[model samples]
Target chain A: MLSDLYIPGASALHRMRPAWKLALLFLYCTALFVVSHSLMLGLGLLLIALGYGIAGLRPRHAFDAVRPALYVLVIIFAAQLWLEDLAMAAFVTLRLIALLMAAALVTYTTKASEFTDGILALLSRAPKWLPKDKIALAISLVWRFIPMIRDQFEEVREAQRARGIERSLLALVAPLVVRVLKSADEIAEAIEARSLD
Target chain B: MTTRDIVLIALFAALTAVMAVFPPVTLPLLPVPITAQSLGIMLAGGILGAKRGALSIILLLVLVAIGLPLLSGGRGGLSVFFGPTAGFLAGWVAAAFTIGWMTEKFWDGLSFVSATLICVAGGIVVMYALGIPGISLMADVPLSKAFMGSVTFIPGDIVKALIAAAVMVTVKKSYPIIGQAA
Candidate 1:
């Protein structure tokens, strides 16, 4: 499920260095906060939408990016309208939409490996005692384990359901945690055996 | 940290991410959905102790910042850090740390009541303390209003804390991990 997020493309946004795109994203988000005018925020939203087109991503893709935040945005809009004025509500909503769209564009264009490399480049400047290699390993291991754990969770859920135990939180979680911990111990031993530390 | 420590940190981070994959339990009156992800935070700290527990959350956030769709409802990326709920997300780190520290301190006489108290202190008090201000700042709402909006979440969070406490006590008895390693 995680792997399917990145759309393959050779567009300019895709070709740009991950580090530069990340820096621009930071600047864009900060700039959106600074420019409070509604007109400017609307223009920023338009620009980000156009970015999706330039990246060879469909309009649906752009919508997908902001879809998850739709609930929160709507609630904020209603709250701001109640608390302040219509203009203020529109301003806050538009600003958040623009920020979400811009960030999504970056994710749509960049690959996970490229993002990890850019992060490593940034972390390289940290203190030597930070164990950069170990940090990288830890991040990769997290990526690896996410799907594994999700599958394990599914397996445990199925097993519990078969036992006619539905809607019990403890029944679902306790076995999963026990299995995860047991697997983790084996994983640690395997990593040690390989001298990966 | 030992290799096992690093692995445990990664595993806990993965566990948290997995929790987000479950559909959130939505209530008719509440604006926000109740999520299982916070329960994962409590478990991480109670089982892994202070340092590794906190580190696991940091690692999870780093992945989120890099645009992994790890958060509930498949939301992630740099924008999440700027969202209205960003404060709650940030607070998870401290929440885990507080729970881990307190659990360790109470390890000698840890009980369901004590564990639940620790989870409430960290998961609810500390989380809302940071989260309310974040909503005020980002949504441009008054602090009092922000606090009012968040009141809907307390009952759900308390339930999560109870579940976390039960799970921790059970795990500690069956296969203890916290303070077992340096």
Candidate 2:
């Protein structure tokens, strides 16, 4: 998810340390929480957009950040409108948008290595028994699978469509289960082969 | 650290950080926002086992502690624990331990369903236990009222549990015996 953007060349926004960038992100979010005024939240949202532009992220990338949650936000806005007022709705949505882009820009630019090293550096205070290597392996698994899961999701859909059983939960989910088991077996066997012991 | 190890750790941490930022589902009845982040927590436990899972989460929380806007709604920083979600945040550590312990406790063999249940309990129930007290104190509502409000999250929690189960199965199939040791 962090490496999806194709924007060429590193810019200053991308160059900011992940640690400092995270600090700014917190400040911006806190500002969003404090700025109850819609006009002001709107300004914050615009500022986040400017940050995105500075990071050299395309407008489409920003849309990609909010697109999945777009419908959900609409429902949330409608409910907030019913329970609260229009201004509150506007404020809430702006809060959501600003936070999303600001975070997206961070993930969009910061390399995963920076994130891990940043973490290892941070965790130096922990007890000596903690196995940092095992933790690193697990993190690698998760990172390795982000795109893999999405790809499998599509592959499942395509296979279902071909099988003419796109409508059934049994059909849709069964393959996912089967594939999962198959993958687990393969992973286990691979571990056995390497015989790290 | 090996180059490969660095890549792996970074990837999982990023996966979790992304999940943490994932927007919560808004149900009409509940004031609390639900998200898929908890499942990520469970997955951290199941796939990484306890030590690694805990470490990955520690890394994520460390980012938050240091003031990264990595939480849901783009909220982060040490101050957030003072907010409504602090309990859930703290629960991540406990939940990871529970998941790892349960998944590895099979003396007979790998009982995927049993492991899944244990992980789910850690992921859902333990979190609620921690989170409710947290919301009770932070929101300053009666414990029961705080609980009643959070009960709305059960439906979402169940979904997260099921998804965690599915993902656990995936891990078993694709990457069984996650580390070098069988």
Candidate 3:
């Protein structure tokens, strides 16, 4: 599910260089916080939605992209409501949603290979004493492991549910750790066998 | 570090990121949701030792900064770094380092109880110390209110701490990932 967000399309964004897409994301993220007026933020949200459209995405794509963040957004809005006024809540919410949508537009349009390549390129230029290759490998491993772990968690939960036991972290965590460590051992063995180091 | 060290670091870092994918348990009153990622943080510290555990956490944050939706609830990117949750996210690094360092110091003699104590100190106390101020500043809330609100996290974190300790002891008994101090 982690990599499934990128819908394949030949939109101009998909055609743009990965570096340029990343640069645009950076610029938009920075610019949104700098211009925090409600009107500007509202316009930014509209612009980002338009960006999704240009990237051959429908309004539904934008909503789906933003949906995961809705829980956090509601909490922030509620907190702001308690502390400040509706305008402040609205401003913060819009600012966040705009920034998130802009990022998602890039994410949903960019291919995984391009994104990984961009990351590798960026890390290659890091100062000496940092293990850039190792970092890059770790990033790729993160992507690979996310869905695997999600699946493992679901399976563990299902087994526990079938047993009719109470849903508890204690019941779920130990087996998950054992499985994760075993998989890590296998991954390490594979890397060592490949002598990729 | 050898190739083995690098692999362990990467594996634990990936574990931490994967831990975030679990659905969060949200308490209705508190803004912060209870998550299992902090348990992963404590386990990384206890299992991987000090420097390696901290490095793993830094690696995870680096990925988050680069716009991977690796955080719980699929939140990521630099925008999250500037949001109300930034402090807690930053605290992950410190918490991991503190717990790992303590675990390393007492590596041979540490029991599950003491390891759990370290987790609470680092993962809960240190995290709140950083996170409360972060909310007060970033979210524009009062420190008193933020501290009061964050109390809800304590019970959840205590559970995570105990679970992390139990996992570490069990894994050590079985697989023994961390080497003995020379």
What does candidate 2's lDDT look like per residue over B1-182, in tens digits? 33333333444455566655433556677665667567667777776667656766776675555445565556554445434456878798788767866776652355556765776689878878898787555433457755765676787776666667666665576556454453
DockQ of each: 0.68, 0.11, 0.40
Query: Could you tell me every candidate's TM-score relative to the true structure?
Result: 0.94, 0.53, 0.81
Tell me the interface RMSD of every candidate, in Å: 1.5, 8.6, 3.3
**Tens digit per residue, CA lDDT, model 1, B68-101:** 8888777887668877788998799989999999
Please give, for residues B2-104, the per-residue lDDT of candidate 3 as tens digits: 6566767776777777777666766566556778788888888888887888888888787676667677767665556655666888788888888888887
Rate residue A189 of model 3 by lDDT.
77
TM-score, structure 1 vs. true: 0.94
**What tier of docking accuracy does candidate 2 attain?**
incorrect
Categorize the docking of model 1. medium
- The parts of candidate 3 lying over 4 Å away from their true place are A1-4, A125-128, A143-168, A182-190, B20-34, B62-69, B74-83, B179-182
- Please write out the lDDT profile of model 1 over residues A1-197, one tens digit for every residue: 56626789999999999888888888888777787777778778888977888999997887887788777788789899998899899888778778777887888788777888877887799898889878988998998999899999999889988998745677777888888899988999999999998
DockQ, ranked from best to worst: 1, 3, 2
Query: Lowest summed lDDT over 10 consecutive residues: which window, candidate 2 chain B?
Result: B1-10
TM-score for chain A as predicted in candidate 2: 0.70
Q: In model 2, how large is the Cα lDDT of residue B93?
A: 78
Predicted candidate 1: what Cα RMSD to the true structure? Answer: 2.0
Q: List the residue pairs that clash in candidate 2.
A: A135-B52, A139-B12, A140-B8, A181-B173, A183-B173, A183-B174, A184-B172, A184-B173, A184-B174, A185-B173
